[model samples]
Target: MTIDLINDMIPPLKITDDATKALIWMEELRLHALPVIKDKKFLGFLTEEMIMDHNTVDAKAGDFLLKGENCFVFEYQHTYEAVKKATDFDFECVVILNDDNEYLGVVVLSDALSIFSQSASIQSEGGVIVLSLNQSDYSLSEISRLIESNEAQVMGSSLNIDKNEPTKFRLTLKINKIDLTHVIATLERFGYKVVAKYQEVKSISNEKERLDMLMRYLDA
Candidate 1:
C-alpha cells in the first residue's frame, strides 16, 4: 500500500536558536526527537538521548545537538522508508527536505507507527485463506487472476513448504473485503485443498450475559 506523505510533517529550526526551549518544545509535542535546520538546509536530528548524553548543562546548544551532513532524507521520498533510514543513523526521527534542501517536514517513528495502526489489517476484517497444493501449482500471475475474479485484492500473503514432505507446499492469502464462503469456493474450485480458516466464530452467549461475564472477568 502506498503511504500518504502528508501525515508526516514537522517544523524545522536551528538548535542554537534556543536549546532549552527546544527540549521543552519536544516534550510538549510528545516527541523524543526533532529536526535541526540552518539557512533552510537540512541538518541532523536532535534526540532526547543525545541531549542527555552530554551530561553537561554548561555545553552550548551546538555541542548538545547532532552535527555534520549524515542525517536527513529527500523530502518527497517514500514514507515507508523511515524505519530503515532511522535505524541506520540511530535517529528517532528523520528530517525531510526538498531538492534545494528547503525544509519539508520531519517523520517521527511514532507518527509512522500511528499511521500503520490506523490502517486496515486483513486479520481484523477478512479471514485467512490457506491452501494445500503442489509447489508447482502455485503461480503468482494465476493467483492474482483468481483473486481478482472475486473482486478482491490480496492484502498480505505467506507460503510454507511441507517440512515433513517435499514438493508439497501451503499458500496463505489475506484478501480484502470478501466473505469466507466465497473465498473457500474460489480456492476449492481451482483444486486447492482448503486446510484451515481463522475467522471469529460467533459465540452462543447472550449479549448482556457476555458483557456481565467480561466485566466480572476484568474485575477479577
Candidate 2:
C-alpha cells in the first residue's frame, strides 16, 4: 500500500494560511503545489501558478478557488493509483487519505517513483530480454514454456506495440536465471527475434540508469 510511502516532509497548508505562506512552503520544498487541510479533512491543493495568477499573496488559501480537489488516493490503495492521480492532474504530489476521507499525508511523485523502481520484481536479480514479433504471433504461454525448457522462469513481462512498426510488438521479459546464454539460443531457434538483452551482471547499474532516465523524462 501507498500508506508507507506518505512523505512527512510535505506539511499541509491550513485553509487559514495566506498565499504568501503557501508560496514559501512551495519554494522551500521545491514543489509546484501543496495540500490544504481543515479540521483533518482535505480541502484540495494550491499551486504556485494559481497564487501567482490571481496575485493573491496576502489572501487566505480558502479565499481563492483551489485546484486538484480530486488529486488523491486512499491510503490502502496501490501505488499505481497515486501515480495515476499525479499524472492525471499534473500534480507534483498526491494527497493520501484514510477510509473516511480524512487527510493522512501526501506522496510526492518522485518518492513514489523511487519506490516503484525498488519493487521486488524490478530489483530482483534477473536477465531481461526483448523480443520483436508480429502482433498475431504473440503467445505468452508458448513463450513461457520455451523459457522454462531452458530451466529459466519468466518472472515478469511487458508487451508494447513496436513504435517503428505498426504490426510488430516488443515483448520484454524478465527471466529468473542470470545466465541467458541458453535461453537466448532457445528463443532464436524457435524463430523469436531477440532485439535486446540485458544480462544480470549489469542489473544494478541498469536499474539506476533506468530510474535516472525516467526522472528526466518526467521532468521533460
Show pairs that collide, candidate 1. Answer: none
Residue 33's lDDT in candidate 2: 91
lDDT of the structure predicted as candidate 2:
0.82
Off by over 4 Å in 1: 1-10, 64-71, 87-91, 121-143, 146-152, 156-220
List residue ranges in candidate 2 displaced over 4 A. 123-150, 156-220
Q: Which ten residues in a row have the lowest lDDT in candidate 2?
A: 211-220
lDDT of 1 by residue, 111-179 (tens): 655554443442235555666778888786787687778787776565667544568877666566547
What is the RMSD, in Å, between candidate 1 and the native fold over all Cα?
10.3
* Whole-model lDDT per candidate: 0.59, 0.82
Q: After superposition, how far is residue 159 of candidate 1 from its true place, in Å?
A: 16
Per-model TM-score on C-alpha atoms = 0.51, 0.63
